[model samples]
Target chain A: MEGRERKTLVLGVIGADVHAVGNRILDYAFTQAGFKVVNIGVMASQEEFIQAAIETSAAAILVSSLYGHGEMDCRGMREKCQEAGIGDILLYVGGNLVVGKQDFGPVEKLFRKMGFDRVYPPGTMPEEPIADLRRDLGLA
Target chain B: MELSVKQMDPEEFGRQRQEVLTAWPTGKEVDFDEAVAYQKELPAAKVMAAKLAQGKAKGVTYAQPRAGVALISEHIELLRYLQDEGGADLLPTTIDSYTRQNRYKEAQGGIEESRSIGRSMLNGFPAVNHGVMACRRVVESVGVPVQVRHGTPDARLLAEVTLAGGFTDFEGGSISYNIPYAKDVPVENTIKYWQYVDRLVGLYEENGVRINREPFGPLTGTLVPPSISHAVGVIEAVLAVAQGVKSLSLGYGQCGNLIQDVAALHTLPLLAQEYLKKLGYPEVMITTVFHQWMGGFPQDEAKAYGVISWGAVAAALGKATKVIVKTPHEALGIPTKEANAAGLRTTKQVLNMLRDQTLPQTEELTLEEKMILRETRLILDKVLELGEGDMAVGSVRAFQAGVIDVPFAPSRFNVGKILPARDTTGAVRILDFGCLPFDREIRDFHQERIARRGRDEGRDPSFQMVIDDIYAIGKGMLVGRPRG
Candidate 1:
């Protein structure tokens, strides 16, 4: 998995959230799952995510927000990527996106509308995202 | 401008309220006349101060859970479930992050998005964006008194809207909200903002409407020494009292050690009352809240419940006025509504069982209480001296000079010089006092405690110990030990 020309993916906890537990967990999981993980750590901004994506030539940007501000924090991330000449980059986000209990369908749709290619719900397992990335990137 | 802990003039407050109300379109919905009338008509059960006083007088502890969603209707339903199903004695409307940052336009967008999708898209109830009438719906829907529990540094507008919407309690203070939550916000600015919030509460007091105010107690909620948090709590209480607030509740986060947690709960009220009386607010009604563990929780649900039950026991034996409950799913991120309700039920069971019991006063308990009291006095006294008798000015200066430091806080304004680690018995003690003005006796006590743990663990006290302790509980251990 290490030297086999593995696909690269950028991951981080966006905005001002410092919930590093999940970020670290995801990093370990993705690395173990054979993706070349470029972990940006917590408290990452939009520009940082795009810059990392460009630098790593990553296939996707997986954003996690655990402090319940994902909706506000991830508002223009896709547009930011587009502005930086990476409009085709796959964007994924998950965790508690909003403050209250809402159906996951609309939340997924909202992120999709925000230009995210894939949106996961809170409590989603790592396997789901890893598998989805494999199919989305045509690496299966 | 240098801000002093002083009451805002009524006319000045009114002028500010005008500006605050116009910060968002929802501001126009707040009419003081109508709000007061609405509040006067609320049932006694829905009044925060009345409920707290009742619990205090009866020696019973109320239970509250943190919960909120983006949609108002869903938020109302969630509170109802917590009240009727979870048996919560009080309710909380945890605001979304957008509202906490005063990003009302984003919150408005969240509300619209939630409505379109028939789901909540924000992490909390956007009371400011929901406007006063929408907030009123939440108040009317819940059977118990509701408090606005949020981490907003500048909560002036939030207070105006929520109180006008009939929220009877508000949580957070300049220091509590800033040090742990923000990275660049200055202490002086938040202190000035909160003065406006308190003056608004005072205005309600003048009109015979009682709202309970709580200073966020668990600064960083890591291995913070009891004295550091206690000092902040007492100072916030003093600051609130000066702003015409009549009902105040000082809080402490559960630190996992029974004796130290009990001692903190015991001494916090005594110290707050002492400070309030000395500051000429002898009539202010004081209460206590015990927050469940605020640090990293174990990932296993069963282990998490063990943590929750321990916090419940502490809150009960400590005789807190109310206990903030935590869910077993805490380690897994935002808890489902059922999980939130489960925590409330667990807490309620503990409180009911311990109603007729009390922790027997022991010699060790007495020593811990005295130690906490002595350490708290040293920090608070230095803060007062730094401000030249002004708690607000002293608070900013104290943080600047590292006299009062919270471990693991994110604020750049914080000195971040203090380090804390659990002693042999798992009681948090200062590993490094930084520039705290503790006398030699207090410093020696902390040093000796850490030394004892160091001797037992066969290693010198260092940053590794702090690092180990942070992950210790999550690994099913109180003290992190070297791998065999």
Candidate 2:
């Protein structure tokens, strides 16, 4: 356990958001926290995520959307992943996922319905997702 | 990539307009004849060029705030608040991201979602998706002129819809919009796209409509030097005028140094006029806008107010026609309407107090102006030389050769070789000149400035200093000094 292989996670800003800063920060944080992070960078479509997940055999797919169109962008992503033969892979999303300030409860529930295992609001620190990933993946 | 700087032929433009109008449902609502009629009836006060000219003639600096919400009603209400309660002299309709990327369908969805939720789901007004009628309502709701401020590389359709909808001013240039806002968009494509936009403005002018065109002055808004942004602004202005755009507004983002900021503003209009006249477009009306510090802002509302006030003072003393106001919640995410109004109020108060006080013609100010002029001339001259007297061709080649480079841009087309850092006085100076066509004297000046700052800080001039300066303001400091 002391020298166990790190869990691989695919991370990116989904849809057309080219928010490089947050993506870079997350890449650094996950690497520092001993996870294998394959940051696909920004403006990634759902197909790109599936391809990367298959290529890296990633344990989780962390999709980030900052430009408030996450609901539309994330819709059907789970079904797409299942069709791509990676249905069991973990899915997480965070950021200013929606435009306007809707209650986080409903937002989280909506993402869960879309098959995301975890949802984070804007300004969510990297550690929160990392800790949750450890428990969910039994890496703890 | 074979871009033309010539005025678009009427027949060609008309054919293109047909395709452009059919891009989205809202586009279909823009009837050129009706739009022209609507624009003719708009009062002089709602005409941006008229307001800017009035401000310039009277030596007054007008205040404008960036604000837009999803719903048309809410957006109009927000702008009204900025105009009435905040005392904003001009208003803006910031288009949402989806619309900026020409994804009108998603923007339409955002508008409907915002309406159902009773909150703005989109970050900005989807003016294109809302079409000519909704935009006209927005323009009519506010007493002041409303400018279309969005970062769209291919804004041809947007320009057509917005100008037809009664927006008197349009912001963004090919270089500014592409280098700063896009990752893989080619410079030539955006330039060609913007030519269509400018040609549309020209057509409106021919039909007796006077629309103001502005090239976003702050390229990356990091530590952009005066010369780089100036060259881009002048180039865009020349391009616009070539397409028959009559009224042009060139802008400069505030650097913290008082003398440098003042000098940048002072020389922008003068240089633009000289270049425009030299380029055989002497009749073009030019105006200058000073954007209140476009970089990182302090999270503390009070400190942010201080920064905003200093920007206002610069704009006033520099005699810029207008200043884009920044809110106190800049360090946070998108600001609330109240915060936006607060910022405009702060800027208006400062502008009023310093209206009569002129920036003194001190030796430092003169030297700064001279230095900026010299650097700007060198870059622009090389660009012209590269184009072989054709700016459209030269701009693409200039960027390809890295003769004109924007620091910290993510665009694959951008060279991203230049590195900028603050001088001893917190004036942004080039640390690495990249491949900019500057002579040895200009290089020596920037080297000496950085060396002096490094000597005082007991460290060498390096990328670390540039990194520190990037995060300095957010950390409550102008120059990011190393912690003791």
Best by DockQ: 2
Local accuracy of candidate 2 as per-residue lDDT tens digits, A55-133: 9999999999876778878999999999999999999999778765456799899999999999997656678998999
Cα lDDT of model 2 overall? 0.87
lDDT by residue (B27-122, candidate 2, tens digit) is 787877888899999999999999999988898999999988888788988999999889999999988887888888888887887888787777
Backbone clash pairs in model 2 (N, Cα, C under 3 Å; residues 3+ apart or in different chains), count: 0
* Minimal lDDT window, size 10, model 2 chain A: A16-25
Backbone N/Cα/C clashes per model: 9, 0
Model 2 chain B: weakest 10-residue lDDT segment is B1-10
The 0-to-1 C-alpha lDDT of every candidate, in the order given, reads 0.87, 0.87
